[model samples]
Target: MILPNSGLMIPWLQSKLDTARYVTAGDLGGEMVADSRKAAVLIPLVLHSSGSTVLFTERAAHLSTHAGQVSFPGGAYEVQDLDLVATALRETHEEVGISPARIKVMGCLAEYFTFSRFRVTPVVGVLQPGFELVPDSNEVADVFELPLDVVLDSRRFERKMVERNGQRGFTYFLEYDGRVVWGATAGMLLMLAKSLE
Candidate 1:
């Protein structure tokens, strides 16, 4: 059976996470670094009659980091926030005009480390149908959606290795609309797909 389109229904997506293993293990066998910055990202799912769709934004080219890249709506965590979930929601509102009230947060996915030293938690949320989206022109270049089915299909996900700092590392990439979804954002989605499966 296919996964539900609404974010409200994702808990039924199943829990593939091995909580014991994740919690007991440290750093997934990588060296723990002190510079790890805590961040959060919003993985907004829009349920449609056709299928559930995942939303993404193209960052403005002028941004200092990850400019013109496709990314979820999120940013670094702030001390004033209650938790990572709030950071995700606030960032989504600032970047895409998506009100926190309109989102039904399912839960958070496992944290993924970025090459830039950020440890980001992905907050999964469902957007009610008929909500309007207003992209922030200064930060977001464009907003787009991809069918959830397309993203969940294992055949479409590919792994490629590239050399960094003289060491070969692996990365995940999802191709759609002539655009590539990769890096930390894609890694989080891959984990979501695994959880759903």
Candidate 2:
């Protein structure tokens, strides 16, 4: 796969994700919960001279849901937010301290619906060099970067059936740093990775 360097990624990815033919996890068939909760996630791509990487956060173990799981910086939409995009941007800043000014919003992926009842929309953004992270301990345990090269590579992710007892469907998983990236979060990444292909 021909990937773009950090400096050139904004427009390239913007056009690609914004215009490409894509499919979300919901499209792959998932048994969603009743009156699904609407949410969004920021797929923040940090640009550097070496290459690009997608930023991910480890949810705080004390959290009631998705604790210790690796995911993008985001959460459920708030009533104050205008849209899912705003939800993503606001949550990104709140969770990781990367201000909206440092990021150039590219586009968004189709929403991924999970058994947990979230209809998550993945918002793509390119983080200009020098963006900093100050994670909120209450919501985030740690922050890490996943190389875009490795993330966009097909070999890194595996497809498996999600056997949620009576609720069954497909999801993708990519292991990194001993933690599992799966379900709705990994599914969003899978959609982005596949869209690039």
Which regions of candidate 1 fall more than 4 Å away from where they truly are?
Answer: 5-11, 14-33, 163-168
Consecutive 10-residue window with the lowest summed lDDT within model 2: 24-33
Error of 2 at 114 (Å): 0.9
Whole-model lDDT, candidate 2?
Answer: 0.82
Residue 4 lDDT, candidate 2, scale 0-100: 78
Q: CA RMSD for every model?
A: 3.4, 2.0
Report lDDT (Cα) of residue 61, candidate 1. 95
Q: Global lDDT of each model? A: 0.77, 0.82
Residue-pair clash count for candidate 2:
0
Cα lDDT of model 2 by residue, 1-197, tens digit: 78877677777887777678866566247445579899999998888789998888999999987778888998899999999999999999999999988888888888788777788889988886787788999999999887888777768888888765366777778886676788777777778887776
TM-score to true structure, per model: 0.85, 0.91
Best by lDDT: 2
Give the per-residue lDDT digits (tens) of candidate 1, residues 1-197.
Answer: 27764554555643433331221111222234358888999999887776788899999999988889889999999999899999999999999999999998877777777666678888888886788789999999999998888877777878787554344567678898887887667777777776666
TM-score of 2: 0.91
